[model samples]
Target: MPYIASFDIGTTNAKGVLVTHEAKSILEKSVPITTIQTEHTAEQNPDQWLDAVLKITKEWLSVGIRAKDIAAITFSGQMQDCIPVTAEGEPVRPAILYSDARAGKQAERIKDELGTALIREKTGNHMDGTLTFPKIIWLQEQEPVTYEQTASFLISAKDYVIGKLTGRLVTDPTSAATTGVMNLEKRTWQTDWLERYGIAADKMPEICPADEVVGQVTEQAAKKTGFAPGTPVLCGIGDAGAATIGAGVSQQGEMYAYIGTTGWIAIPTKEVTYAGEGVFHLTHPEPGMHIAIAPLMNAGNAYKWAMSVFGTNTKMSDKFAFQEMEEQMQASDRRTSNLLFLPYLNGERCPVQNPDATACFIGIKATTKREEMCIAVLEGVAMGMKQVMELISDASDYKRITLIGGGSKSKVWNQIIADMLGLEVLVPEESQYLPSMGAAALGFINLGWDSDYQAFSQRLTAAQTFERYIPDPAMSEHYEHKYRRYIKLYPALEPLFETSLDSE
Candidate 1:
């Protein structure tokens, strides 16, 4: 039986899933990877991503999954990464992650030199430090040697891996859209914009559609990954695009929220409509559609931080802390507390684009304990998503939203989102695997096993096993009143995280 290998090179891990043509899972493997971080930098060794995938595939082979049994390979990976590479497909430097915002000045320069409206009109994004173009500029100005040695720049993690596999230099439209260089409508790079930014057009990879077979595994990649040398590889979409498709959001105006290391709320539309500067527009996996995503830089990571702070300090392992925190949050009474948390631990992108914003607990009393603070963190992230949902769609557009991600596994957080949105939140049993499932669906289409994204959606929806969290009427008013105040707190605090005195 032919199987599809789908991988998501995520911020926290490299996860791969093997699924049949009809999207039935065969085996799954994940390897945890490290991230290097500081005040203004977040980076990972792209070599780690390559290493992780190789290790996973070897494990899959050990389990009797033949190399030739894998019919096609596709990927869903982190977006907006600035990875400089040599001609030999080696990473020149650690990949600057999407959360890294060290290019604020460069972003401002682009917005200033080019008209704001012109940039927004063409790129469908407000020029910001979180994008790839400004980060490239930052590399040129700050680290001239790395910039000069770079043969090409790639936006998504999977693009780097694909280059190593097939020696192909190509990116999908979904990843290209995040660069703030592509003409969002045409799904092609703007050569003139690249020239204006002093980036060579040749350094940019060719933009390809998501479902196309852009490359085939080389003998070298086969040696490293234990895959058949000539196996076809599809140009898969980015992680958000995968989530959008996996959640069965095929119809227009259908919305879904994904909470991983980062989080986003997305709704598909027939036209590209400008909601705000923070909102992101991407070409949908299916052609001629757009997915407007309002993203949160801090979601599951905030929960991770809260556990580190409030959990047991006796050990560094999170397995114990998570179980203990889950019980405490569930056992505690959350009704009386008016405490609110701002989940901007790494700053925010959507709802507000302030990169220097900080997180804080408001309305905390001397009597407040760790349990209440933990509950506030969950509520705070949920509140942030509520702001994004309103931005991406009309109030009536999304009757219910499919929520998928690592955070979707949390029953407490899931219920909070349902209560906050006043809508049903469906968590598919395979929430953590949806992005990879979406990748598999694309692989199936390329293999001629499925007709279109809608067909895949219908097939998956009919067989999906999900846990539904219905909205709680008793807590809606409580959350609604708190949300009114949570929306106002950021504006009041923005001036505090302004331009650094030491930056100049």
Candidate 2:
């Protein structure tokens, strides 16, 4: 069986997964990448990504997965980061990551220069620091030499790797949409948008469908990474977009919630869409589909923080750690009862859209125990999801949801999401490999192994029997009372969080 290699170039790490056309896993490995930080910027060396990719690919090849059997290679990547390359395809500067908010000033300037209505209508995304356009503008002003020397900008980790492999430059529509440089109507790069930001039109890659064949692996890349020299390289999608398809979120109203380092609520849609005010609607990796989205910075990270801060001794044993914590919660009758948590540890996106937002624990009692507070931390993250769902439910009534990522593994967290959101949650059978499976599915479709996506998806994905937990009537009521109050705490403390920052 021909195997498809999927590279997921994530923030903080790069992962390579090898899977057969039947969606069977062959081998997988990961390598870490650094996130360089300043007071206001989070950047990663594009070369670090290249190094990690090579490390991971070599590790996979060491396990006996040969070069020739690898029929196609594709990628899923951290969304919205811009990777600028020279005409000769060398990275000009470190990538501006998705979480970096240094472009706030540029974002405001762009909105003022081109009005929000026109921006949204054209880009199908909100005017935010997270998009590539503002970041590109920031680069132009701050690093004029680098900006002038660049050839084309690619919008994902995988795109950078693809460029390395084939020496060809292009980006898929989903990735391009996040750049705020794609024409939502024409389904191509918007030269007008690029020009508005003073970006040369030649600096953009050819916008293509996710499954479009871009080029073949060059001799250098094939030898360095062990992929065959002539293997077809497919233009892949953003990680979330690929994962959504991997989890079988196709057609209208099918929703998926992915919680890894960050958390997101995505609803696949048919007709070109917009999130109005509080959300972003970006093109999906699958051609002709779009997704309504709300992403939160600190869901899994919040849990990781709690484990590190309070349960450090048992951090590696997440299930055991959480099991003991939940036992404490039940013993105390949900004692974190009135306490509420704002899960903005690294600021917030999606519904709130505030980068300066800070996490806070409110209603702490004198008797609040460490474990009880830990449970509140968990509940607080769920509350954040509830807040997003409330906004989404106001626009669309979604009946069922699919869950993915690290959070999906925890039954306690899964139940919390279900109870808090008041919805049925479905986890895919290949729960851990959704993005890889999605990437492989793309290759399968392109390789003519599957006739239609629907048929392939049905065979490729199965719903894991989710341990459903309906909202506890009283607990739900308590959350309603707490969430109303929780909503006020942020605004009330907003000035204080900002004021404290100036003192530094």
Candidate 3:
């Protein structure tokens, strides 16, 4: 039987998964991508991503899986990147990651020129500095030499690898949407917007459907990646789009939450109306559907920080540190803790758009224990989720939630989320790699193995049982009181963030 190999190129690393027809993940590998970071900027070398794919593919072959057995390859990766490449697909410079907000001035200038209402009407998103188009403008204005020599500015990490594999500089609408240039209604590049910015149309990548076969792997890519020459490659969607479909959440009112290194509450909808600022409307891989997203820059990573700083010691192994922390948190007898944490370690995206926001613990006293502080970290992220859920759903009868990603593995955190939101949380067996599996849907379709994304998603997720966390009715008043307090802290703290940054 043939297999589909998918690569999820994320912020800090590249994760590769080999999936079977039954949606079973047989082999998995991860490699770190070197990041060059400074104040208000984040960048990566695209060659490291290509090297990771090569390493993972060869490692898979070493384990007795033949190169020919791999039927097709696809990708679901980090969106809204700015990677400038030459004519031969070589990187003109480092890639500007989605997290970087150095283009704040450019974003405001774009908004001033085009007007936010017009941009929102065309793109279904707010003009934010963290997006690709603004970063491209930053490049053109700040580094004219680099911008002038660049042939194309790639926006998705996977698109760079695809160009190496198939020599086609193409991207899907879901990925293109993050560029702040794609016309969401037409599902194509809005050349008018690009032309207005004096960005040449030729620099844009070809827009393609997610499920369509773009081209076959070239002989050069074949030699490096250990794949059969002419192996088919697919135009895959963004990680959020993949995760939404991979979790089998295409139907209206089927909402989901992802709490990994980052977090978000997403609802698959048919509406284009802005629920609120920072609520991203991403086009689903399946046509005619849009995934309304309320994004968060913090989640499990905040818990990770707490674990490292407060939980771990030099003598403890990483595994033991995690075990110890879980034990400690579970050991705490307080049903409703008095402490709180603001999980803005890397700043925030929704509810408030401030990048200067910093994390801090509130209600700290002489009596406050480290264990109580750690528990507050989990509760803080849950509180953030609760706020995003209410905003994104917009009282549209959202019943249950499917929670996925690394954070879903937390028993304490999941219960906290369920209690805070009063919704049953379902954590799938394919929690972390769900997006990788979602990329396989297109590969299966290209091979004539599946009819459509919905059918493929159904087949992939139907047999899996989820870990359910039901909300406890008794804790309603307790959490309601806490959430009210939690929401107020951010606003009270927001004014200070600006002053602190200005001083810095």
Candidate 4:
């Protein structure tokens, strides 16, 4: 049987999964890469990504995986990371990662200059550092040399990989949507926004559908990666969109919640599901759909931070810490931590696009143990997620919620979210790696492993029972009071964060 290969280049690593055409997993592997950080920038070298991909592909092939039997290759990747390539398709500078916030002024300028309605009509997203258009403008203002000489702005990860495989310079619609360069409703690039932002439309790649075969593996790519030369390379979706697709939230009103380093609540919708304000929509990396998205800056990352401060020094291994933390959480108090945590470690997005927000721990008493503090930190992240969900609920009625990601692995965290939202959270089998798995499924669909998306999703996804944690009436009352305080704490602290930055 012909097999399919899919690559998911994530924020901190590159992962590849080789599977049968039927979406049965055959082999999976991951390689870690560096995300270089500075006071004002968070970046990854595009060359580093290419190197990781090359090494990973070669390693997979060395395991006796046949090159010729691979049917098609596709990708899913981190979005909003902007890397401008020279006319010859070489990196102009290190790619600005999704977490970078240096483009704040540019984002504000665009929103002020272009006005929100025009932007809303064009990109279907609000202007912010998280979007690529501001990053592009930032390039022009901050690095004039690189900006002037650049030929195309690539939305790193998938685009870079596709460039390597097919020698074709293009982007998938889903990825393009993240760049704030595509009209969500029209399914085409927003040329006027480019003109307004002083971006060169000529330099941008043509937007293509996620499942469309944009290019084929070259002789060079095949030789290095042990894949067959000329295998079709399909335009791939953004990681979040791909995860939602794989999670089977394709129809309107279907929702997904992911708690990773960052957390987000999304609903796949056909018409713009604008809830007046505070909710944003981006085109699903799929061809003709939009997904409402709101992100929490610190979700799993907040727990990791707490563990680092109070638990064993585990070198930031999420698995080891979670296993150790889970055991301790069961023995701890349910409602009384005497500690309150806010998971805004890296500022915040969605509902309140405040970059000046900071994490906080309040009401600590002498009786507060390290374990209690850790649990409190987890609770804080849950509350933060609840804030976003509440914002989403203001717009639409969300009934069922699918949970995915690293933090979702924790029973404690999962139950907290379920109780907070007062909804049953479903965790499908293989939920943790939904993004990459979605890419693999898309690879199969594009390769003709199945007829349509619905058929493919049904065959690929396996439903599993989730341990439900209904809200405790008393604890719910406690959180309701604490949540009101939590809401007020951030606004009070916002000015101080900005003041500190100014002092520095």
Name the best candidate (by TM-score): 1
Better of 1 and 2 by TM-score: 1
153-235, model 2: which lDDT tens digit per residue? Answer: 77888888888889988887777778766777667877776776678888888888788789999999888777789899999
Q: What does candidate 1's lDDT look like per residue over 299-380, in tens digits?
A: 9999998898888663857777888888889998777889999999998998888877899989988899998999999999
The global C-alpha lDDT for each of the candidates, from Candidate 1 onward, is 0.88, 0.77, 0.85, 0.76
Cα error, residue 503 of model 3, in Å, equals 4.4
Candidate 2 ranges beyond 4 A from true positions: 271-276, 312-332, 394-396, 463-470, 501-504
lDDT of 4 by residue, 331-410 (tens): 88767654778777787776577766777888888777878888888888877777877766642376558888767778
User: Which one wins by lDDT: 3 or 4?
Assistant: 3
Task: Give the TM-scores of the predictions, in the order they appear.
Answer: 0.97, 0.93, 0.97, 0.93
Q: Enumerate residue pairs that collide in model 3.
A: none
Estimate the TM-score for candidate 3.
0.97
lDDT of 2 at 23: 65
Off by over 4 Å in 4: 276-278, 285-288, 314-319, 394-396, 463-474, 501-504
| Model 2 whole-model lDDT (C-alpha atoms) | 0.77
